[model samples]
Target: MPEPIIEIKDLTKDYEGKRAVDHLNLNINKGEIFGLLGPNGAGKTTVILMLLGLSEPTGGSIKISGYDSTTEPLKVKKITGYLPDQVGFYENRTGLENLLYTARLNGISGKRAYESAEKLLDIVGLREAKYKKTGIYSKGMKQRLGLADVLIKEPEIIILDEPTIGIDPKGINEFLDLIRKLSKDKGITVLLSSHLLHQVQKICDRVGLFVDGRLLAEGNIDEMAEKLFNNKEIAIKAQVSNITQDLIDDLKKIEGIRKVSYSGDWLIIKSIENVTPAIAKSIIAKGGSLYQLSYEKYGLDEIYQYYFEGGVRHD
Candidate 1:
């Protein structure tokens, strides 16, 4: 792989005698959509803040595109576009004006800033509302405007904190699509942080799960699932003449079956490896006629919950 676009080594942050982040280490490759996922106060925000040079690290180092953030902040900032959780905008300024003003702050000149603003507004689907005062914009529109402002500098890396927060479901879907396009088409490395596990599960190529101020697990969803819920789930639909609650209770007593839940005519059995055959035998002995039997693979949400509930530990 090309050298990592962002690297953190032993990164830690402390606030009021509490360690918000602890010995965090990770890497983001060039043009990859990496996700930082955790519950609130799980140290995700602190990691992003330190990476962006907006907060001081109590220990360790951060390197963005080979430039040390501690010593080369200006150079790093120049090539980074960051949108924090609370994206602020001047209520009185039009969306176009907000973008132009931010560009100027980044030292972009008049004509170029205007042109960039227009392009970004169109890119983010805000062209029709580009000249409207931001005060009148809805949450989703304001988010689009914030994203446009972040892109104004045309940075090499984009760090988004809870980018989909407070937006409607449709808006969230649109914003995620935009993020995918940015990484795939523009070759920009992205570090998207969010507490919405499902959203992160959908878009991220790889995800790092955090809890209690530490990274608990990190990997692709399928790998994580296999490592956590390796046996997978089995669903059986049956028509029974002699099956009873006693049979279900007896099946529950068998080893290897992790979970058994019924849905309409289906008995869903989640078990360890090779246990489905035993379940089948038990059902046959109970004289239940099987109508349908199938295996369904686990999704990212199930895998994430496995880690979140302390089923796996990173270190």
Candidate 2:
């Protein structure tokens, strides 16, 4: 396995006698989208700042690509890009102009900046609206422009804080797709921090769940589900015209089949593993016709609610 590009150990932060981030420890692998997920004031923003070298940690260590983020801020900043929850752009300036201006600020100007700005504008899908004044741009368009603004620096790591906040569902979907592309195509490590559970659940490769300044859990969805629910219970719902007590009895006899019940035409199943295939096969073997089978798998939202509701799970 590749080494982690960002590593945090015992990271803590305090503000005015309150602990904002507590003994935070986690890792972000290269070219992967790592989500720092939590509600507001969960220290997500503070962690982003520390990763970007914008703020100091009261204690602990942060290393980005082997450079100490606290002491070697210049080296860290050079490879990291940040987009705040609300990105600020000049309303009077055109999208193209905004990126070009930012490129110049990063010390790359003239033709090089123009080319880079134009390419990024195209990359973020804002090229058609590039010449228009950003004051007339919609919130989604502005968000895309903000993305292009950050990419002008050509940073290897991108930190986005609630990038989809206030975006329409369609826009949010598009933005998440763009994020996936950034990691796959550019090999850039992305740290997305947000309170929105479903959106984060959809795109993140791995996630660290934070609550009140501490990380409560960290892993992929399956791992999280295992940690939270002891191998998540899958509910398979099926519709069948033919019903039989014999069919129910046979399904219950199957190994690892936790439970089985039905209502009207809906056959509901509870299992540790996928029993849909077995159920369908049994339906065919019997005189029943399988009309429909749909299953629901547990994701971050379910596990999040479990922890958020104060339930504990064993490793």
User: In order, how many clashes per candidate?
Assistant: 0, 0
Error at 159, model 2, angstroms: 0.6
Q: Global CA lDDT of candidate 1, please?
A: 0.83
TM-score list, all predictions: 0.88, 0.79
Worst 10 residues of 1 by lDDT: 233-242
Query: Considering every candidate listed, which one attains the maximal lDDT?
Result: 2
Clash pairs of candidate 2?
none
Model 1 clash number:
0
Q: Which stretches of model 2 miss by more than 4 angstroms?
A: 231-297, 310-315
128-202: candidate 1 lDDT, tens digit per residue: 998889999999988888889888999999999999999999999999999898889999899999989888977
Reference-based lDDT, each prediction: 0.83, 0.87
For candidate 1, report its TM-score.
0.88
TM-score: model 2 vs. ground truth: 0.79
